[model samples]
Target: MAEADPMKGVVARLDELVAIRPRAGGGFAPGGKVRTHQLGGHRSGFRGRGMEFDEVRAYQPGDDIRTIDWRVTARTGRAHTKLFQEERERPVLVLADARAAMRFGTRGCFKSVLAAQAAAILSWVGIAGGDRVGGVVIGPAGVATFRPERSRRRILSFVKSIADATADAPRAGEPPLAAAIAHIRALARPGSLIFLVSDFFDLDDHAVREVERLALQSHVTNLFVFDPLEAALPGAGSFPVTDGRIVARLDVDRPAARAVYAQRFQARRDAVERMSRERGMTFLPLDTGQNPVDILHPERLGAKPSAAARSAR
Candidate 1:
């Protein structure tokens, strides 16, 4: 099959993403509709701790009897009713990595591109559900901020700015993962939903600790995008590397070199997954080679195999 253009893929996928609506609940239901309450915003009212029952008035003609506060009515000697306070809008932040290192793609597309796509989808989802959506794109130039807004246009603008900002970066870099995490911690308030997108290749223990701290204050979703080739280098012959003037060919066929690189990659991935689990975050493993929409909409992949079926493999 002919490879699709990356830019074209992004545009097409964005269009498809706009069409998706959350199910009746916030989760994706069988019918691709999310329950209204689950959409994650103020429309559902505040359902959490801050919510209080306002004074009940006489039962309105249409008021549900279930909501009547009988004890209040008995004490007041009137048909006083209960009114629960509604919730405020929940903020959702998409913390995306657009570092140079994320620009490499041995197979599929670049991790940076995938991160952008994921951010776009997530931002749109949050906005659609009536939540305030904002984010920061971390690249070599530093963190680019997009304050949370409910407008669809704002979400689109955020996604586009991220794409434009990272377009000029080199395909690799020593990203400041720790600094970015700290930035997120400062920017986001408690109880926000944070979607952290990255290859998570350069993150050190300090960065991971920062992420953990953020997790304590917010619900986090870690989306790890990587190329399969990055995990396992093919048994190809030595490949030539040119540093403009100098040309050097390094043999990857050597078992030691191959093993070391593979181990490092695997270890990084494992650490990321473990951290996510420990922090009670949802960890999604995505391959850049796969369709972006499919990754976001996993149900489209088909019925998930049962544990027995998966284990048999």
Candidate 2:
């Protein structure tokens, strides 16, 4: 029998990721100790096609007859149209980084694989919460975008796009993060939530500016994924590592080198945190060694019951 393709196991899996949907009940679960309650679904803080009635206004020439406020019209003896603030369907777009730099992993999976998994989980959560789900995958070749929509077909299409785009690693000459942000900035309108999942290795000034622009119009969330080793190397002598380009041995036994390595990763993470805080975006630092589900839904783990579960109790 031929040996199995390691990429298949390591890169991305739609089925398993989608299975985590039921875990996504409510709120914006992040790295912080406390919970975050974000409005979506019925609580979505947007005005659009919804069932809830906002007010009644004088009937305009183009007003739909189906939306006539009969009670108000009969009482006031004037034509009025029911203005309903449709509980807006929140749109969530996942940006996955699958460039060459993401191919390396020391533990559970490569950075790119973790990215795909994180995207899938986000997609499923959005779908579960009655939100429009879509994504953009930034691979070596280029980028693939799927329009956000609330339908089984669209959700499946987004998942398939993510899987296909990240199936094989590609080499991107320029910094893919900036381009990905540009795509998101163009697509994002008000009432949209954008999730950017990456190791954030070499984020430049251009990307930070774009993120700020995006935050101005919509909610921006950063899911920074990194290998544990990248954060801190154990004092276990030389460690082999690669970023798909350079294969080198890192001297973990050297305290000075380890401190510098840890500081480098910490600085990148701090940058993301600072940016997110200043602009009111949610930032979650994901460890490759940790479970994605746990990062997304920490309330479900161990002895703690979910908020809903706690309420029922």
Candidate 3:
């Protein structure tokens, strides 16, 4: 038999990373305690096409007669009725950042690799949950968009496309994160769920504001993927630094360099968290060491009560 492809192995491990719950008393858990709520199996929130009762309003021109609530008309004795229409399925767009900086990682794997795994796992969850999944892959080469589609096959294809895009890309200048956010705003419609995955190292305040603008129209999930080394530098002595085209030696122990590095990393993390909270977006900080499958699974994340557990309840 032919040996299994490593990519397939990586993808098959999706279940392991799905729904990884933050440890009890961990900083990531709410109130520093992991809630025991079960989640998974059955869908959460709105599902399928059906008119939901919004609110009764005065009759307006071009309003569908079928949507008019007769009981309201009888009670009020005025032209007022309930409006309803087919509810749109939530479209999930994964905005992946494949900039050059993400190409580096001192532990476990490259940030780019982790990003691909995260994107694949999330796509699987979205597809399995009966939602459409699509994404825009941005790199130095350019941007490519995969239209929202609901199918296991399509999701797999999307993952493969991402893998291909990052395989041979040169590591150089940073890509335009703000411009990509603008593209997402233009392409995605209202009520869409956008997963913005990036290390977010090169973004400016203006770029952050632009991202907030995109979040206004959709549910945004800011997934910050980072390597442990990014948070704390290793004790390695002075090392040579290269800008791809130029090389120079710098002391890692320099007080200014150490201070600047720590400050920059912390500031970026703080900004990302602040933006997420301000806009009501889900902030998922994933370390490269964590399993992607666990992160994608809702049950493991304590999102909702599982079906069996709910029945027991």
Model number with the top TM-score:
2
TM-scores, all models, native as reference: 0.69, 0.72, 0.66
Model 1: lDDT of residue 182: 82
Using lDDT, rank the candidates from best to worst.
2, 1, 3
RMSD of 3: 9.5
Candidates 2 and 3 compared: the better one by TM-score is 2
lDDT of 2: 0.68
lDDT tens readout by residue for model 2, 41-75? 44333222357866677786545688788998999
Clashing pairs in 2: 49-86, 50-86, 50-87, 140-170
Best by lDDT: 2
Q: Write the per-residue lDDT of candidate 3 for residues 1-313, one digit (tens) a residue.
A: 9985544322223333343212332111111112234232222222112456546677754455676778888888988756433345567788777667777665556677778777766665566555677888777676778888977677667776667655645756545888777776666755566778888876787678777776544556677888876786656487775534687875677666777787878888888877777655666787777666555443453333223222211
Q: What is candidate 3's TM-score against the reference?
A: 0.66
- Can you tell me which runs of candidate 1 are displaced by over 4 Å? 1-88, 171-175, 239-250, 298-313
- 1 or 2, which is superior by TM-score? 2
Which is better, 1 or 2, measured by lDDT? 2
Q: Which regions of candidate 3 deviate over 4 angstroms?
A: 1-87, 171-174, 239-250, 297-313
